[model samples]
Target: MRCAPSAGAALVLCAATAGLLSAQGSPAQPEPPRFASSDEVNLLAHGLLQLGHGLREHVEHTRGRLGSLERRLDACGAACAQASGTAAPPPAANPVVGDAAAPETLRNLQVQLKAQDTRIEQLFEKVAQQQRNLEKQQLKIENLQSQVRLLAPSHVEHKVIKPARGKRLPKVAQDGDTAHNASRLHRLPRHCQELFEEGERQSGLFQIQPQGSPPFLVNCEMASDGGWTVIQRRQDGSVDFNQPWEAYKAGFGDPQGEFWLGLEKVHSITGNHGGRLSVQLQDWEGNNESLQFPVHLGGEDTAYSLQLTAPVASKLGATAITPNGLSLPFSTWDQDHDLRGDKNCAKTLSGGWWFGTCSHSNLNGQYFHSIPRQRQQRKKGIFWKTWRGRYYPLQATTILIRPAVDASAS
Candidate 1:
């Protein structure tokens, strides 16, 4: 093999070096300390800067290791080439000539070379994993830095806010827009909220306190059946889920169709809307299943909103499913095959997680991307009894509305 110069590796090394230097030590020196209104917040900035420097040190260490590994790899390649170039000795004139054993020197060298090759391969994998870990850590430190910036007076801002319940959305019902259901009622029962609102971030399991009382804990999980599933905490950090199976079975609390993953709710509105529902998820991998048609509660006159979005229009669009049991096409995404939400009602008392038949479905001359493309991948009409009887129609994008309470008067 011919040896060729590679600029790629050189570029990677340069970038890694530069990144480490910039993160660890700034070229400029700091001026004398000035007092700040919030000393704690100012200290936070200082602490974060220190942490950033430490993270930069860690990065430099990893890059140094990477550089070392690259050199070793290059050396291995050179050695391998040299070995290949030194052709094996021509067949001995006499097969028995080796009876005297032509010095085992070459033989040991070959063995050593093979062992080194194996070691190099192992090192490559190790270095790759290390690089990934370093990248992930750097990302975490950067996020911390972002948080620190939030402490700076120039970086922070204050804003007034109106209540969300009465707010008018940009797109009218006729214009095809919706409001998803979510909330921040910390005082509500633990079984009511699916996520915790921590100032800005929402986490799957979080701690919340209201009215200066003790903090309560909650864990979130999406069920096929509507209502909330909590990771209730015991006196210790242990958790329990004493929920009934019905609340979790397919076609009940979960999304109406196939999903990559699903959630019970996204609280934007504070009130108990109609028909408590489950989440439906989707992604690149396919999920073929029947889908549940949207079911609204209360009379037709009640005000309702939805929040839905998808790739592009080539597929179907995000939609608002009403309890009235009507199939309404709302929006479009990515050409036509991007995202489609077509409603399907169970004609036979039988269905699944979302609720729809499994099979090839062409969306009005458009493509519908999904998985489980086999006959068995069908959402239902068959084995839903084994796996909850609810199948989500792949065509059903998703539904977002505050679930309606079964006990609430319509």
Candidate 2:
């Protein structure tokens, strides 16, 4: 019963030591220990002192029991000798005196107890030494952390470079833009239609994440019916649309001005099979024309091929050409995926498109402010054949896309 508390205390101390060792030996440094303060160390030391006091009290109590047992035995023996003359001995004292092996067993127990006490004292000393080592390591860590804090500003200064006055700065992601992009991406609408559904009416640049893809900027054109995600816009020809395959794939342009909103982004926004495409074309005389059709745009694996069904709506009265750009993979000067064998439609027409036999529509063609003089140069301008043959370059063009289901419902 006396050894029970001591055994429990020993187990507690062993577990604490093991935990401390494992923490210190860890490969990855953990956050600063909570017990690094002087007050915590003092509290631990006080606990150890109390344990020592308890062990000393236990030892004294054991010694007192041994002394009391010897005195009782002496009294019992005297009582037994004078049993006939005096009275009979006490029943409790008689057992201690009559039992021959009791004294030897008690002595053996006393010896074992002394050995256990010595071992406990040794363990206490080891624990104290470990405590001291831990304190020193904590102090060193605190100093290192302080030094790092002091030197961080200097390291940052060394890494930053200031551009000279009147010198054009190199292109890099500005901190403000990066921060803005991050904030915009955190809560993004799936598409422009979603913004329209949520009661947004203004047309402007917006950030969107299609499906589960990374967020990117897009221009949302709002109409009376719904919002439209503008994929390509050719206005003043500030941006060249005749770029090679890579440029078209990654997209090149500004959302505020003329820009092509990349093929990959278009494919993602269009979803599984395809979506609806809305085209707005204006001739040099300001004769505006609009058309909508159900179109399926393939991915880069298919060279972003175009497959359009019959036009759902058209503002360009009746025309001879049908504007059918069906099942023709997109073509560029570098990578020709067009249907023509001898001539690259993109190279010949000086624009990129899903050119089947180099006809139909080339909305991504070269932009002209007005009518061109040369007859041969006329074919290179932005023109939709169904509205105004292939030679009359259109003044402006805007291409927008949305889901086919949404278009049908609208």
Q: What TM-score would every model get versus the actual structure?
A: 0.24, 0.51
Off by over 4 Å in 1: 1-20, 31-129, 132-394, 397-410
TM-score of the candidate numbered 1?
0.24
Candidate 1 weakest lDDT stretch, 10 residues: 232-241
Q: What is candidate 1's lDDT per residue for 132-219, written digit by digit as tens?
A: 6555655665666554443221212222122221112122222222333122222332232322121222223223332223333323
RMSD of each: 18.8, 25.1
Tell me the lDDT of model 2 at 212: 57
Candidate number achieving the greatest lDDT relative to the actual structure: 2
Model 2: lDDT of residue 284: 74
lDDT for every model? 0.32, 0.67
- Runs of candidate 2 with Cα error greater than 4 angstroms are 1-187, 310-325, 406-410
